[model samples]
Target: MADHEEDDLRMALRMSLQHSPPEAKRSKPRENAGVPTVSASPEESPEVKRRELMAAAAEKRMLMSKSVAASKPEKSADVAVAENSVLIVKDENRVLGGTVSEKPEAVCKEEEMKDVNFGEELPAADANQLFSMIFGNGVSRDILAQWSNQGIRFSSDPETAMGLVQHEGGPCGVLATLQAFVLKYLLFFPDELGKFTPNMPSQNLGSRRLSESECVTSGDFASLTEDGKASALVRSMVEILFLCGSKKRAVIATFSVLCQGAEEQSEDGQKDEIFAKTLEGLPIESASDLQKVLRVNTCTSQMSAFQQLKEMLPVFQSRLGAMLFLISALLSRGLEFVQADRDDPSPPLVTAPFGHASQEIVNLLLCGKAVPNVFDGRMDLGGGMFLKGIPTSVEVGFLTLLEYHNLCKVGQHLKCPKWPIWVVGSESHYTVLFAFDTSVQDENELEQWESQIRKSFDGQDQSGGGGFISVEGLHQVLRETGINLPPEKLDHLCSTGFIVWSEFWQILLELDKSLGGMKDSTGLMGKKQFDLFHFNGIAKSVLNGSQAISGVESPLQRPRLSILRVSVPPRWTPEEFMADIVVPPGPGGNDPSGKDTVVEVTKPEPSQHAPLVDCIRTRWPRSICNWVGDPPSIV
Candidate 1:
C-alpha cells in the first residue's frame, strides 16, 4: 500500500510538470568531491566580502597565469584547458613566474643572445651572403673563385666593374680593379707614348745641329706635358740606339757627314758617280728614268732627299747642267740597247762609204754604244732619231757636226757615207749615198745606174699636164659620145698622174673627127655647152647630159655662163652605136613643125674609149691637136 501511494504521488507531480510551458534547461553544476561551500548575507556578512575578495584574488591569479604562460614555451591549448569550472589544477609553483622566477635573467639572456649571434665570426654564413650578392646564383662563383685564386679584388666603381663583366674568365670587379691599377702604374713610365710624338730628332741629328730658329720649341706645342713625355720617351729610345753599337751610329754619322759635305762642295762628281752606280743594274735610260728609280727605291726617304736637293740645285747650276747631260747620255745608250734587242740579235744591214775613221767609231762598234744625244735647251740637234730606216733632219744636223769635225771614224768603228748631200724633190726627199767602185768596166752601166736612181727619186717626171691634150679634141669626143664625166676631174686625172696624156688625147681626136664639132644650135642658143676641162664647169657637164634646155639659163648670153661650161667626156658603151641619124629640130628652130633632120648620132659611142680620150684632150688638148694636124697656136 505504501509503494502504491508513492507511485501515485510521483505520477501527480509528472502530470503537473507536463502542463508547464517549455524553457531552455540550465546545465547542472558539476559537483566537487569534497570542496567547502560558504553562504553569505547582503549587509555586514563577512562571507560576502570574503567571496568578493576571493573572486578578485582569482581574477588577479588568472591575469598572472596568462602572463606567465605567455612567457613560457607554448603548448597545445586543448590539453591545458578543461570544462567551465576548474577540475585538475597544477601546483602554483610548477607554473611560470614561480616564487623563484628567472624572468629578468631570461630577458637579459634573449637580448644577449641576439648580440652573440650577430657579433661572432660566422664565416660560412658571411661567405654565402657574399656569393649570393655577386652571382645571384652559383653560375659565376667558379670564375670568381679562379680570380680570387689569382689574388684579384673587386672595384668600387660600378661602371668599371660592369665593363669587365663581359671578358671570358674575367670577374667584373677584379678586371676593372686590375686595369685601373695598371693604368695608374703606367703613369710612372712616360716613354710608351713617345712613338706617336712629332719633332723627335732622327738618330743622325746627334752629328748635325740645327740653327736656333729651326729648333723645335716645347712652348709651341699644344701640350707641354705631352712634349715632356715625348722627350723622355725619345731619351729612352736614344739609350736603346746607343746600346745597339757604333755601327748604326757610324751610318748616321756618315749620313750626317754627307749631308754637311753636300752643303760645302756644291759639285761632287764622285758623289754623283756613287749615285749613278747605285742605279747601275736598274733599267734607267734617262734623267727622268733615274729620278723615277730613286723615288721608288728610297721610299719615303726620297722626299727628304728631294727637299735637300731642291735647296742645293739653284746654287750649283753649272754642275747640275753637266750632270744632266751625263744622265741623258747614259740613258740614251741604255735605251738603244733595249730597242735594238727588242726584235732580234742580228745587226741592221748598213751600206756606207770607205774612209779613214776616228777612235769614236772603234768605240761604238766594240762597245755597242749609241752616240750621246746632245742638246742646248733650244734648237739643238734633236739626237740621231731614226724613222722608217732614215734619220730626220735634226738627227742629220748632229751627225754632220761629228762628220765635219772628223770626230767619228769610218770603217773601223763608225759607219761612213759616200756623200754629204741629201736629195730634195718637188714633193719628196731621199738620202743618197753613192758608193761607186772606180774599177767598174762599163761607163754605160754606170750612167744607167745614175739615171735609174734619179728617176726613182724624181716626182716631177710623172706625166699628165694642162698642155698635153687639145680642147678641140675634147669637144669632139663629148659630141661623139653622150656619156659624160666632169672635165675638171678628168683633167686632174691626166695632170696628177692618174691617166696618161697620150691616151687621153687620142680618143678625143677620134671623137672630134667622127662628129665634126658640138652644135651651139640647141639654141636657147643662149645655152652653151659646158667645157669639161675647167674646174667651175663640172656641174654643167651633168646638166648638159640630163637636163632640159627649156628650164636652163643660156650660157652664151652670159660671159659667166661661158666660163661655167665644163667640157666633160661622153660616156657610152659598145652596145650603143656611133652613127649619123636624123632628128627633128627642137622648138623655135627653122623647122617650125619640128620636121626630121639628119644629125650625127655620135653621142652613143664606146663610153670607155671616149671619156679616157677626152680626159687626155681636156688636160693637153692644144698639144694633142698640134701633134695630129697642122700645128695650132693652142699648144
Candidate 2:
C-alpha cells in the first residue's frame, strides 16, 4: 500500500513541476537537463499519464547516475557517508522546490542571521505595562491614567518616547523613573509640597560645609528652569538614590576623578584602554566641560549638566544605572565615603515594596540612619543627647501613623516634626498630606510650657519622676494653675483614674481657650496659666484621624476604672494601721512586749511612695486615715 502511495505522490509531483512556469524549469538542477521530459495532454488517460511519469523519472535517475559516475571521487567510507547525507538533503530540497518556488539555502542563511542578531534589538514593551509591572500593585493603569489626566505623560518627548520603547523594564528603571516623576510632580505643584533640608552636604565647590542656609525648599526648586529641574533630578538620583549618600562632596569628588582621567587621556593622545571603554561614545570634550556636565555648583553649571542629563535619562531608562553609576561615583572615594554615621549592617536592598522601603532608601530621603520599624526612634543613652533621635519627620501611612501615635511611645521629634507634611503610603499607593500654613510647626512656646509643666510634676511626684503623675495630683496641679475641670469631666478624661504624663499632656492639649486666661509673674504660661489653647488647633489638625477611642460606643459611656480595696479593722489608729496591716510580721512571729508587738518595717521615703499614695487617694477618696506628722504615703 505504501509503495503504491509513493508512486502516486511522485507522479503528482512530476506533473506539477512540468506545469510550472518557465522560470522554475530554468532554475532546476543540472541532472534534469538531459532527461526526456514528456508532455501529457488533457485527453490522456490516467494509466498513460502514470506510465509517462514513470518513464521520465527512470530517465532522470539514469542521468543522475551518469553524472555521479563521471565525477566519482576516491574517498573513504566516512567521506562517502557525508556525501550521501548531503545528497539526501539536496534531494529533499529539490522535491520541495516544485511548490516553494525558492531555494532553501538563502532562507536558511537569513534565519541563522536573525537568530544571531536577536539580542541586539530591544524587547517590545508598552510604557504603562512596564511601569505597572515594575511598581507592582502599587501603581496601576487607573493610577497612571489619573496621572496622565494631571498632565504627567509617560513619554513626553521624542527621546523619552524612544527610551520607553527600548526601556529595560525592571525595578531599577521603574524606581528611577518614579523618583524623577516625584521630583517633577513637586515642581509642578510647589504649593502642595513642603520645604525640607536634607542632611546632605552642599552641592557647591567653594563651601563644602553644610549649614542651615543650604536648605533646598520647594520654592528654590520651583524657581528652577526646565533644564535646571532636569539637572536637579539627575543630581538627586545620583546622590540620593544611586549612591545612597548624605554627602554631595563624595559625588563631586568621584566625578572630578573621572574628568581628570578623561583629560589625561586627551592630553597624552594615548587613551587608557579602561577609560576609553568606560566612556566609549560619550561626547565629553574637556575636564571643565565634564565637570560642568556632571557636577552642580552655580546656576550656569546646573544648566550645563541639565543638557547632558536630559540625553542620559533615556539611557538610564533602558539600563540598570544604579550600581553602575554608584561604582563610577565611588571610584575616587571609597565606599565608606557615602556610608551613614550609623546604618543598618544588613545586606543591601534586593527588593523595594511600598511600605517596606529599604533602610538606605529611607535614610537618603529622610536624612537619618533610620530603623525600619515605625517607632519613635528615641533611645535614652543617659546624656544630654537624649534629645537626639532619628528622623524629625517621616513618611508613613495613615494607619501606621495612627499606630505610631496611639500604640507607640512616640518621641517629641517624631510627634511634632519640623514640617507640617507627611508622605502617606496606603496599601496600593502613596500620597502626600501637607498643611498650607507653616505656622503649625512652630510649637516652641507650647513645648516650653509643656516642659515646665512636666518638670513641676516630676518635682512634686515621688516615683523618681519617670514622666508620670497621678490623676488627682494632676487635677490639683491644674486647679492650682487656674484651669479647673469638672469632677465628671476629669473622670472622663482619665479613664484609668491614674493619669500618666502623656494623658496629662493630652488633657491640657484639649482644653478650651476661655480657661487659658490665667498668667504667672514671669508672664510665661508655664508657671501659672497653661494657655495650651494656642496650639489646640494645631494638635487637632495633626491628630485629625488619630482618635484614641475606636469601636462601638454608647451615648453615655461609663469611665473605665481599675481599683482594689483591702478591708481593714475599722477602729484601728494610725500607728495600728501601719503596724498591723502595712508591716509584715517579724521573723520570730511576734515580739514579747504583749502590746501587739509593733514590728519596725524598713520602708522607702515618703517622697518615694508618693505615686502609690496618689493612686490610693484617687481610687478611695471616702476612706479616712489619721496621721502623725506627715502621713506615710502608700508604696
Candidate 3:
C-alpha cells in the first residue's frame, strides 16, 4: 500500500497485461503515475532499503493477481483458473521472491482458497527432496501429505481430516501402540520391508512431486477395516522409508547389518542374506517337516514341535512382510514385550512366535487353540496364504516370486535405492522377502508369576464353586493388595459388578502370548484366525493328536472359562508392568540373565503381603475373625 509499492504494482500490472490476448488487453491504467514521489536516498540504511524492496514485491504480487484476472475475464466462472493462476510473475528478475517487510496476502488468500476443500485440486507446493525419492513415480508430495493427514490432523492446520487429540492414550488407543511398535522395532529394521514401497516416477517437478493417480490421494485407505488399514499404512510407510535410502542414509548406517558378501554391503544386506540361505535350503525342504514345525503340542512332557525342529534344523532367519496388523494386535494391550517377574528386574528377550505369545488373541481370532510349544517357537515366517477359507503355509520358492524389474542389477551391488527395482535374471522383479525372527519366545518367569497371582487372590473351593467375584470384592482385594488397575481397563473387564476369575487368568495367558503388550483381558473379541501364530483351528487338531493334554480344549470349541487348567496366570498388576519401561542388557548382552532388559515391577514382600484377613475385613467389618476354621498363622 506504500506509494512506491503502488507505483511498482501499477507498472508490473501493465507489463503482465501486455501478454494477454488482444481482446483481454484493453485495460486502462487506473492511477496516474506521472507524479514523481520522494524516493529513499542511496545513503539510507540497508534495512530500510530492503523493506522497500519487500513492499514492492508485495505490490507486484497483487498486480500479478489483477493482471491475471483481467486476462481471464471470459472464463469468469472460475476466477482462480487460467492466466492469473499460473504461478509466473512478469519480469521474474525484477520480482522480489521474499517480501519480509510485508506478509504476502495474495499467496495467503490463494492457499486459503486451495484449502477450502480436499476435493479441490491442490496447487503443487515445494518439493520435499526426501519424499520425492521415497515415493518414486507412484506417490507424490500431495499424496504423502494426504496420507499423513489421514493419520493425524492438527487444529491449527487446515482441516482436511479429523483434528488430532493428543492425550495420555493418544487420539486413538491403537495409534499409541502403533507408534511404540514403529519407534521400537520397525524403524530399526527396514532392510526387507522397504522393497514393497512405491518409488518416484520422475526426477523433477514444482515444489512437491505429485502422483498422477487420484487413488493416491483418495481417503479410501481410511475406509478399510481397522486391521486392514493398519497393515496398508505400515507397508506404505516402510516402502517410503526404503525409497528414502538416499535421504535417510544416516539412519540407515545405524540399522544396517553387516553382510558376509562384500559386494552386498548395505542395510538391506541382512535380509538378502537370509533370503539366500532360505532359498538355498528350500530345494531340500520336506513338506511334512514344515507342517510338523507349526504344531504346538507335539507330545506330552515334550517342548513344542517348533522347539524340537529348531533343535534339529538350523534355525534360519527369514525376512517376512511387515505384519503391522498382527503387531498392532499384540501391542493393543500395552507396550510390554516380555513376561518377566516385576519384583525381579531384568532385560527380557523375545523367544519364538515373536509377537503372537497371547492365547486370548488366538482365541479371539477364532484360532481356537495353539500347539503345545508353538508359542515357544518362532512364528510361521512364510505361512503361505489362506486357501479357500482355510490357512495354508506357502510352498512357493523365491525365484518364482521375483518381478525382475532391475535385471541388470542381478548379482551386482546396489549403491543407493532407486526405483526399488531388483534384477533377478533376464527380468526385473520385486523382492518377495518374508519377515522372520528367531528371538520370539515365551518368558521364563511367565508361569511362575501366574502361579503367584492365583495363589494370592483365588478363593479356593475345591468342590468346583464357580470362580465368581464381585467388582466390589475385586476392588477391596486390589486395595488390600496395594494394586491399582486403570479405571478404563477396569470398566472394560467388569460389567455389572461380577467377573469370572478364569477370564482374568486368560489375560495373563495373553501377556505371554502378546510378548508383553497385554497385562489383562483387553481388546479381546471374536476375530478371524491368524495362522502365522498357528491360532487357526489347526492347533486344535494338533492338540487332539497329543495324548490329550488334560483340560486343553479343541480350538473348535468355544472359549470355556468355567474350566480351570492346572496352569493359570494371575491378575498381573499394572504397577509391575510400568516398572519395566526400559531394561538394560545383561553383562555382554547375552542370555546370561536369560531375561529381557525391563524394569522390575516391585512386588510386596511377605512382610508387606495383604493378609487374607484384611481383604475380608472390608465387607465383613462386624463378622468374627474365625470362619468356621482358619490357618494357625492367619497373618
Model 2 over residues 269-339: C-alpha lDDT tens digits? Answer: 23233234433444333223333323211111333333343333432332223323332333213234323
- Alpha-carbon RMSD of each model: 52.0, 29.3, 28.9
Question: Which residue runs of candidate 2 sit more than 4 Å off their true CA positions?
Answer: 1-225, 231-248, 252-348, 352-357, 368-463, 466-512, 517-635
Instruction: State the local distance difference test value for candidate 1.
Output: 0.25
What digit string (tens of lDDT, one per residue) describes model 1 on residues 453-493? 23332323233433332444443344444424456645654
CA lDDT of 40 in candidate 1? 40
User: What does the lDDT come to for candidate 2?
Assistant: 0.33
Using lDDT as the yardstick, the better of models 1 and 2 is: 2
Best by TM-score: 2
For each candidate in the order shown, give its overall lDDT on alpha carbons.
0.25, 0.33, 0.26
Per candidate, the number of residue pairs that clash is 32, 0, 57
TM of each candidate vs. truth: 0.14, 0.31, 0.18
* Ranking of predictions according to TM-score: 2, 3, 1
Better of 1 and 3 by TM-score: 3
